[model samples]
Target: MTVTDQTAAVTTAPEIDSEQLRAVLEYYFDQDWTDGLPVMPVTESSLAAFLASTDRDPEEILFTIGHLNRSLSVRSAAINAALAGCKPEYFPVVLAAWEAIAKEPHPARGIWQSTTGTAPFLLVNGPVRTELEINSAGNIFGSGFRANATIGRAIRLGCINVFGLHPHKLDQATQGNPSKYTAVIGENEEQSPWPSFAVEHGYAEGDSVATMFVIRSVVHIEARHTMVPEQLALDFVNTITRSGALIHEYTSTLLVLVPEHAELFANAGWSKDDLRTFIFDNATRPRAELAAVGKDALSNRTRWRLPSDHPDSTPDTASTTDEPDTVRLLSHPSSVQIVVAGADNAGVSAVVEIFTLNPPREIPFSSSRIG
Candidate 1:
């Protein structure tokens, strides 16, 4: 039989018993080939299943991981997906996510190498969410569900096994967050008052889309008391623009609002655009304060591409040390995106800040369609 990738094709497949499986796990650990978690063994059959799920050929070059100087193929990605315990049906979504991260726009290399311990935050939309049973309700980001756990694990394993981003090797994250384990969520489109996130991003209403954001941290905001849009808006503004907030010249932030909290804005006749505008207008930090925190020094000359503003018009404000002057945290209302997710019972939202090199660095958020 002809094999496409050596990683996926076992020249002489082993018929391993339970004892041999245990030995294989130990062997992978000894080689530091795991993400500190026991990976499901990758088998030839499992690899073939993943490849057959996708329309692409097994030998086709999927994408190249530049940091490790490795060219990833469909077969290799399938092996990593199998290693992460992904169901064969989930392979298409995995391939889409991998393709998104491989682009220069997404800066997968920087996110993997950064000291912020950033992990990719994946948000899936459309029928795929229900089909895959990805958690979009209470404890959506927590452990328990198989789809959420393994899908995220598959991506992490790709970074480890394919991209060679093991800790102390290429991944130099200091005090990395728990999201590095698995951070995947589906948009609660049923509960959302506005159009789904995928719809807003130019995809058809029912299209399956997967968006990847390089997240440095996830700050959960509890707004149980707030009933009005103004109150909730202020809470969001304060949270995203707090002192020591990681707002750089090119920061893109994601606000994942639970349905209950999102209702506050909808009740006030606030469209998604209106909510984004309200947050952008209010989220500001004193320029001197940012400079005091060494942000000004850390700022770069590269202009951040905000969805609302043209790149050329947004002047470089990295050196402005005006103490009394308030510097806007977001360049455009589009910089801070609002996605309705989570359960409706509680008023919990999340502020996911993207990873940046220093200040004034750009990290792209890429989306891919899943069939």
Candidate 2:
């Protein structure tokens, strides 16, 4: 069967058993199914084992996902993750990630199942990073930990197997970012003096879970102690805004301010809102000026193309706001979301901002204590 793309072929999910799993694997092999490795088969027993790892009821409706125009059962997902080789302990984080992506505005269905080459990234917060042995330091996005490796693949498999999301069709990604095969997570907030992702999102600390979404490249914003708040913010705005933060409707930044860098902002009385406002005002660029940097995508005839290739979307805050002059420090505060993270070194801290509108939402990585 020629599956044109993810949205092109829609099929009802059949009961997945050991037999069907083998068949699918066989078909995959026949079709040369691969992303640098052979995918494991999604068997019923394997899925059951993953479900057994979680504390939630197997029947629990984690999310009525709308990505592929169909809802997913936890059973199906467990099976898919199991096939991807995610440990049973990774279940809770996966569950939370699905829920987060399923949030109406998050557009899990569109990006998850689309041919946009969009890949879901899991950003871990709270103290569970260490407990789960999630790597947030050097080579965090590379190989080594099973949690970081398989968790992302399992979700991708679910989007493929359950929702029928496929590459090159529904996912018309221009370059198909590396986040597709790699996972993104960091150290827990308990390791630092600042609040973790969950705490920032109004949840308690020490919760274990993951937040997933589509993302572009991640930018590292460094601020050594030599720079104060003004200088640090200035450095961050210049650094991140240069990475195509101008056109998307909503771009959530994962600000990994090393504690030292964070303290500069803290000392300057820079609240999150303050930083957002500053970035919004300064990140702007003149329309005439933006087109010079291969930003023809934001030109008058192509502006709408940003949100929907219609050429009506607003240009980057910098271009729209600073039309007449070139004092463009930056523009559009809404484009920025700041979060504290990183090792506590004496000299410098960093602000790692993931560029693009497909970044994950700002909810901290904490499971709701209600359950």
Candidate 3:
């Protein structure tokens, strides 16, 4: 459908002086449209610039929160992008991130409504990383880069303005983390020992892609004392299988390796696959350890039980022999996603724990090619 026809039902804002930034900010704040921060005025020229960057029809539906019956259009996304202070050239990456989220099997249930305080963690790959100046080095997750900050903010703003997922209302995060505001980084493909994450996922090496992961927490791993790959891998495994972090057997983790750490593994002739296998093989905890965190009963009832005449029988039932003494943290080796990023100076890495409230199923990793 055309932009004019599709946006007919969209509520129009009252005319405000585009030149008066203070008045525009106040207007949006009063309407509960801002994310507790100053937002750029959504001017006609700015919106037009954002729209011109993408070939998609302005009213094309990007995704819908099925339960709320709220659909986000390309035009609405552009509006949020403008409000988030994104450059017009960054619109395609924003749309691609949303497209990746929409491709998930159950975005509304699995992502938007989770009380675990999960937020979209975006990874930009390919030449667009350099084109937009998305930071892949030196405090990559920290503040500085406009493209990284605004692109992520655009997604959060859409969740608030378009879907009404306001905190203490629809978004019932117990304790949201810093990443809830913005979390995006580019893959340091230039300094990496392997191909870009997009290429590994079957996209062409030249293709720019945006990948989305709904994460609950990020734990930093420091291994400054060791040059051994096994030692670093053990540190990562320890972080991954920590008592507080291991909430499910099918939990997935994104291991973001700094250039220095990546080099340590590469020097040892270890491929990404080898590192993944090592992590999967060693990141296990004894079933008895669950009792230390008061999760034994829950684990037994949900995962170690047998099928009976109960109507709501879970499919994760295990046979007597299938129930091993030690429980694996991840479902498979591939669950430990490896990506190289950050400056070459640090021996630091980060383990991003995926949202796994609904477990015993494959976690959908979503990626879309950037325009």
- Structural similarity to truth (TM-score) of each candidate: 0.85, 0.71, 0.88
Model with the higher lDDT, candidate 1 or 3: 3
Q: Looking at candidate 2, what is the lDDT of residue 220?
A: 60
Error of 3 at 136 (Å): 0.7
Model 1 TM: 0.85
The lDDT per prediction is 0.76, 0.58, 0.83
Candidate 2 lDDT over residue span 1-371, tens digit each:
56656435444544457686677777776754434456776566667778777677776665555535666667766876776777777777677777766653434436554443556667777666776777765455567778788877777766666665556655566676677775656643544445565666666665654555456556665445464566667776676556355444334455656566666666777777786777656654444454554443433542322432434544443434434444243224545655555456543444444333333234322233211
Q: Runs in model 1 with CA error above 4 Å? A: 1-17, 291-324, 356-363
Using TM-score, rank the candidates from best to worst: 3, 1, 2
lDDT of 1 by residue, 267-347 (tens): 889999998888878877765665565453332244432222333334345335453366666667777777888888888
Query: lDDT: which is higher, 2 or 3?
Result: 3
C-alpha lDDT (0 to 100) for residue 10 of candidate 1: 62
